[model samples]
Target chain A: MLKFTEDHEWVRVEGEIGTVGISDYAQEQLGDVVFVELPDIGKTIAKGDEAAVVESVKAASEVYAPVEGEVTQVNEALNDNPGLINSDAQGDGWFLKIKVTDASQLEALMDEAAYKAYVEGLG
Target chain B: MSQDHDVQDLKRTPLHGLHLSLGGKMVPFAGYDMPVQYPSGILKEHLHTRDAAGLFDVSHMGQAALVGPDVAAALETLVPGDIQALGHGRMRYTQLTNEAGGILDDLMVTKLADDRLWLVVNAACKVNDFALIEGALDGRASLERAEDRALLALQGPKAADVLSRLAPDAATLPFMTMAELDVAGTPALVSRSGYTGEDGYEISVAADDAEDLAKLLLAQDAVAPIGLGARDSLRLEAGLCLYGHDIDEATTPVEAALVWSISKRRRAEGGFPGAETIQRQLADGPQRRRVGIRPDGKAPAREGTPIMKDGQAIGTVTSGGFGPTVSGPVAMGYVETAHAAADTEIDLEVRGKALPGRTAKLPFVPQRYYRG
Candidate 1:
């Protein structure tokens, strides 16, 4: 199941590993992600940590980690086609796959309904 | 109790709701509700203008008129430009200078009639400009605030062809010329002028007719409503200066590299404010100058990035971003005049790291202005 962090990154967990990217709402705000500077593979990150830098034409933003884990893979294709994140943020735009260091971190994420409500409240 | 009521408070244009519906990330800009970009994104929007056409809602800019028995003389006293020499139906770009030779604001001035001068100024600086102009005129001329006016710019390569259908005469108005016309049956003032380096036109109409004008323009196959995001990139690509970021009161026209706006007559006569100081700078050359900077790598150096020479901080980046046309990072900054020459090696302090950069000629992307 997909879960969302307050920072707007989305994660889909399976066993002790998960794929992470930004929510559609976050991608829409960033406006045409031109470049994505990814975290190196095998790098460790804590929950809510700034994982990568995403630059748009007008401004730059930091994409944060949803849960503590070791980066196993990064979407290298994003270097050439960052617009993939703007077009299909939740699926193909996944930034990286992580090997969860602690499974309990997933429990802190919000479910779909909670995230939907949270985003609505933002408006 | 409505969140939108807050948006309405800060001057909403006709397309405010449309921007929200398009999922435009709304932000406050120049005391107005504006869309920085839509879902297709800023980069795409930026590239779209370079590739096709981008419609810009620039209604936030202040539109006023200096009307008097001797409007040209009154305007001349405030700005250094030779207002009298500007032929009727033509516009000139110039700066309002302070006594210290500092730029109060850079603006566009047009001779609409024998006794009227049309003025467009920075939205944020309009109030101050009005007061300053009024004070400078000292009742010699009257400043008429055209608050009921709306301004829109259709910019890009296809702009002229797209706008020609509205007023066939617009197609012939040569750059810097303005004329009254009926666009889509609504009376408007169309000018062959724009901030984008691309060939484009700016239309001024009654505020009440803005929605109809915008819809009619958008209905054309070549038009797309651009937001503030593309505006910044387009202007940057043109090597145009943004008021607060690139040119400010602290910087003179010479330092900002806008000495070209000073007319030969004004340069010789020296009757305008800051005449002595500006003349001195014009003759001796400025100590620091604005120049284009191209980073050696893909990392973009943005505003406030410290410029370095020999590993020491020398100046700062004014505006920087990814140039879609160049397919690389480009920037503009102020460096010591010695280092301002093209091909000079420099460094930009980006993200706490010194990135290799080179001084280069401006308009990193060649400007495609249609002078003919």
Candidate 2:
């Protein structure tokens, strides 16, 4: 299941793990992704906490955690080519994988259809 | 949401419709609804400008003329640059100083004639600047604000090739020189200068002719419409200071690494506002000096990030971001004179982490201005 947050984060849930990254809308608004600071594999974070930091040529933005979880792994490929987020924001650009500790928290996120409607209103 | 100003209250430039047609993403800047980027994004726009040519709409800035008897001498009273020595067709960058040795604003002064001087100042400070200039030069000279004019900057390596095609005389103009010529059938004041450290021209024209001029420039295969996003990064990489970010009312020319703009005559005579304080700093050196910074890693240390030395706070970053040409993060900030030397080890406090950094020489990328 794919979910999105009001802050423009996205999470792809599979079994008990959720792979997180910023939504395409967020990446588009950011212009370009030059640098990305990701959380450690074992870091514990709560919902809405800053899980990663993305730097564009103009400014920096914090990527928030969509739900409470412990980080299990991070995408190391982004260290060299952060532009992957602009090219493949939802796929190869995934920031980290966290083992979801509270499944009920996922229910609060917007689904793909709902996120499209939400972003539409913003424009 | 783009800024504190309401969207309905934002002013649009002459090229506002053209910007929209080119898929520009609009953002508010200094009360104007300016384009921050186009469909190409800032990274591409910045690199493209370094390699090719980029056209920018800077009409939002205040344009005016100081005319009548002894205008140059009159202007010298408010600024530190040597206005009397500035030859015809030449331009000089100087600051509008306050009484306390701080910069009220920085602007370009172009000598059109002995009695006429053209000026370009920051958009946000125009109202205050006009009032200050008129009040100081009262009866000595006349301040004529040009509200119907538009300014466009054409910049990059290929800028000459694109601009010379429009105005043949522009091809021979050297850096810091201006000419009253015709560009695309419109009368313009063309100067071989710009904010980006590239060979370029700044054309001042009638507001009604702006869109046509922009379209003509953009029609060139090498020229693209660049927005504020790339302008910031380009200027940052060139080691130039943005007014509000890197310079302000509290920062003086000496501490901002802009002492070169102060002429030898002005430095000795000490006639302008805050001259006593400026002379003192020139002799004894300033408390803090602006220096370029390079983070050891990829993370960018943005504006307001504190500079650390052995866990002690020494200064703060005023301008910083990723440089598309240098392919790294670059920053400029003020640090104590003791630790301002090139290659001095420092740390940038971003968020809660102290990122390792070192003070580096300015213009992360080599400035390529064509003098001849």
- The digit string of per-residue lDDT tens for model 2 on B301-358 reads 9999999999999999999989999899999999999999999999999999999999
Worst lDDT 10-window in candidate 2 chain B: B1-10
TM values, all candidates: 0.93, 0.99
Q: List the residue pairs that clash in candidate 1.
A: none
> Where does model 1 exceed 4 Å of error?
B1-5, B14-25
lDDT of 1 by residue, B73-98 (tens): 78888788889998999999999998
What is the C-alpha lDDT profile of model 1 across A10-99, one tens digit per residue? 999988888999989887766667778889999999988888888877677888889899999999989888889988999889899999
Q: Count the backbone clashes (under 3 Å) in each candidate.
A: 0, 0
Interface RMSD of 1: 4.7
Chain B TM-score by candidate, in order shown = 0.96, 0.98
Query: Which candidate has the highest lDDT of all?
Result: 2
lDDT, candidates in the order shown: 0.86, 0.94
